[model samples]
Target: MSDQSALQAVIFDWAGTILDHGSRAPMGAFVKAFAAFGVNISIADARGPMGMAKRDHIRMVGQAPAVAASWEQKYGRPFGEADIDALFAAFEPLNVASVRDHADFIPGALETIAQLKARGLRIGATTGYTRPIMEELMPLAAARGYTPEITVCAGDLAAGRPSPLMMWHAMAQMGIWPAHTVVKVDDTLPGIGEGVAAGTWTVGVTLSGNMVGLSAEELAALPEAERSRLRAPAEAAMYAAGADIVIDSVADLPGAIERISASLKAGKRPGYR
Candidate 1:
């Protein structure tokens, strides 16, 4: 609530930030996708490129040296476009089928978004899922009363996260200009990079995202000291990757925005501070 330009909008990343509390679906899909190609990857590898478009993410994993080596051993050739397509094909149905199961709204996500909308800030969302996956997710999320005014999926843009096109698309569709007036909330490094590339205040959500990848129940089961121990590195990684601020979850977003608003009033912008 500084005298600076009023916060205009918040662009959220779908999976971990709002729906799919722990961002679980994509990781499993990516693992299965690679397994179909005879490339076995650890969950850490699967999560490495989290927040990029699904196809792009598959391609990235396929191109990794270990995966590529596995492919070379399995098929006597390098991983290529055909492999990427096959992996994506295998991944799509599994992802689509399980998306609904993961569609539960993260606790406080709807409430936080409602609060933002009440304050007159536009709600927009961008996601790594393709339009079809979003088609599945949207109605489920809407049924829970957490629909954004604008949603731009991966296939809808020429490029996806870390490229900033999806963010730009959301801004354009919402008719919001001056990127600094916007805030981007995401759960992964690539998503943070997208916001930085777009020159917006970027807030990273830790426990609910790729970093922790823990369900609310599971996270709650951990002792307080253990939870803090688990969160520190993920927070550090996000900050090092260019997040302007990092919070525990989307529930903490309003406070992050208030702090960012103060900075905006002080003439700070992403990459300028």
Candidate 2:
């Protein structure tokens, strides 16, 4: 059998894989929101909740339960609910702005999708953003000539990544019934877990995007061993969470698929290792 028969669809994560540095945009929004509240948080701190629901992630970043106390300790003054609301309101604009303003197609992303489509495979997207946010992004993305055959917005459903609902829904809508016929690509642990839980083949993309914010210069500066150092954590996370294959990036997807096809042919499930 041809390798294509092993995969009927390719599911992708929107922010980081299809667009450039997905998490970085959200991180900037988080930093901006915290700065507005007089609670300074670094981008590094904001990235910790990358794949979570936006509001939930923001709440964690904002230290919601003890917002006043946390702000008092961190900023030398207590912040009121109004202050928190104002900060979150400012951050809210970023949810749509990130995709509309800076959602450039990742290098090789379109070409890869085109190649897969040529092979008769459907393409899909999953994101933590709400449906309205996705509506806002679709036009902007289309304006720039990027599109996915199917798109799953986290808030559109009851649950997000790490939950199989979004993936299952996307597959159903795309007419791909067999979970193993679809391959999910993502840079986050929850996303990988969602794919695995949905029983779809999973490929973890690790290079130059949301999973890591390595600049081209930074990536080039690292030796192969050091590069693996940067990627190992994400790989381990995805593997433990249920990824079938861990790839370096969307650029490495074709090769990764080849490897997955080989393993599947050999009758080895991806996470068995």
Model 2 misplaced stretches (Cα beyond 4 Å): 1-5, 63-69, 72-88, 215-226
Task: For candidate 1, write residues 1-273 as lDDT tens digits.
Answer: 322377899999999889787799888888887787667998988988999998999988888888788889999988899988888889988899888789888888988998888888888988889888888889998887877898888888678889989898888888788889999999988899999999888999999888899988898899989989989999999999899899999999988888988888877787654
Clashing pairs in 1: none
| Candidate 2 TM-score, C-alpha based | 0.84
Against the reference, the lDDT scores of all candidates come to: 0.87, 0.73
Per residue, candidate 2 scores C-alpha lDDT tens digits across 109-177 of 777777777777778888876676778778777787668877888677887877899999888897776
Question: What stretches of model 1 exceed 4 Å from their correct place?
Answer: 1-4
Evaluated at residue 18, the lDDT of candidate 2 is: 73
What CA RMSD would you report for each candidate?
Answer: 2.0, 3.7
Give all TM-scores, in the order shown.
0.96, 0.84
Clashes of each: 0, 1
